[model samples]
Target: MQNPPLNEILIGDCREVMKTLPENYISACITDPPYNYEFIGHKWDNSEIQRRIEKVSGKGNKTLVKNIPYGSGLAGGVRNKKWYQRNRHNILDYEKWCFEWGEQLFRICKPGATVLVFNSTRTVAHVQVSLENAGFYARDMLVYKRSSGIPKGVNIKQQLEKKGYEQPEKWDGWHSCLRNEWEAICVLQKPLSNNYLETLLEYGTGLFYAKEQFGGFQSNILEGIQRDKTEDFNVHCTVKPISLMRKLVEIFVPRLENSILIDPFTGSGTTLLAAKELGINYVGVEIVPDYLEIINKRLDGISGLQGMLPLSE
Candidate 1:
């Protein structure tokens, strides 16, 4: 395979792109694949609607997690049995999609390599199960607790009152779901060929650096108080904070000279940028050409990273 180029974003679908890489080429993976749920803010107007339409569906640049149309029964229009059935079907499809790339990832990473996948708290279990089915072991689930989050669920009492239902007060203060404060990080690992120490000696993997940046041990729950610094150069709607990505990379990625970290769904190139900032090697795959350009721009702007990257720095 001649070894895919390092520290660069490959512009193609990860499922196909990863197949071309040599087996066991990557040491660790830190990625946030599509959540497969189609959505936009409900409080948007015509102008915002048009912008989102152009961003996700225009020009055939639909390689995003929200590839499914907004009004599809699968994506929540009415809460009928048909909608539930459609949603379940899409959920299954999403799990299948996860496995397709996860299998390739399992083949490309060394035994004992870790994969940290950020996804919706509701669906992270599906991601874990799909990767486990693809020959990786589910290790632990990490939580990223945000300082604030929007409550996107529908208010039950308001809807009932609008419908003139009897005793809408019965559903006072009720909503469909909780506030979207925390997200799930599905921690997965390729099975080791030997004991942890032996695998560490042989493959330079099979363990994590447990030391925390703030001091003491690394906890499963990651609390972030820093504001997003990607706002300067990033247009990706779901750009993770550079602080979060760097911490994940520091803990899960090995420091061996030849070791490489990868982000199969390198949205806005945050993972690659984090790895580079830490003197680690990285390779990335982004299916969207528009985002690939954005990634290159972000990477090229790395010289100002200490000021323009994470709010922490």
Candidate 2:
């Protein structure tokens, strides 16, 4: 098959857009999918938690309030009560949902292609099950550790005292949950030929670049600061740092000149930008139009490649 269009962001459902591409065309996939937290509050609504945030952070602190939803007017818990309610389906159902897309990804990827998928710790097991069920072999899990993380949950004793109820003194240290400081990235791969050298020569996959480390040596744990928006690019809420993405891409696509990376859930095109920085080809698909615009604006600032690759008829 002719080379599928590269260095472009297609606006559509990933599953449908992937159908148009040639089979076994993608060399690697690096993506951040939604955690399915079901955040329902609008940006404008000012809840008690927002008011508290404003009070503590002072008024006009746009960074704290922008695009974040505060449910139950309280800070704590991995997700708000509403989020749990919205995603009330059984765990099996959620795994099935993952399978629907994982199956499509498995079909489009080249044999021995590497897949790096970001998932919350809470749901990573389900994602792993789904990917394995879709025929991808589970390789290793990388932990992307961030320096900063929001602490969730409230002090049970303090809440009781505020409500005029007696509580045990030993409960002072108890809380609902611990602060989340890391995200799990599942590394998976398609089946490869028996001979590793032959597989790499035939499919341009089945190998990882260990020498291309971001910090001298590659470890399962990746440490980096979470980067926000800059003057040139609008940042998505859950944007992975460009440095982190670049390192992962380098490891996945060692021969950057010949490989084409694909990001099915390209929120703001960070993976695409990384590919461009490395002078590698890439195709991204974002379901949201607003995010597509943001991606285009981000790509516009990049002078690497011009215009989209024309899709084959």
Candidate achieving the largest TM-score: 1
Where is model 2 more than 4 Å wrong at Cα? 1-3, 39-90, 212-216, 226-229, 232-235, 304-313
lDDT of 1 by residue, 191-242 (tens): 9977897777777788988986578998999995475765565656677888
**Cand. 1 TM to true fold:** 0.85
Query: What is the model-wide C-alpha lDDT for candidate 2?
Result: 0.73
The lDDT of each candidate is: 0.79, 0.73
Per-candidate TM equals 0.85, 0.79
lDDT score at residue 223, model 2, on the 0-100 scale: 78
Error of 2 at 100 (Å): 1.1
Put down candidate 2 lDDT per residue, 197-281, tens digits, no spaces: 7668777788887753345656778876456455454645556788789888777775545578999989888888888877778
- Highest-scoring model, lDDT: 1
lDDT of 2 at 114: 92
The ten-residue window of minimal lDDT in model 2 covers: 37-46
Q: Relative to the unseen true structure, what is the Cα RMSD of model 1? A: 6.7
User: Distance (Å) between predicted and true CA of 221, model 2?
Assistant: 0.5
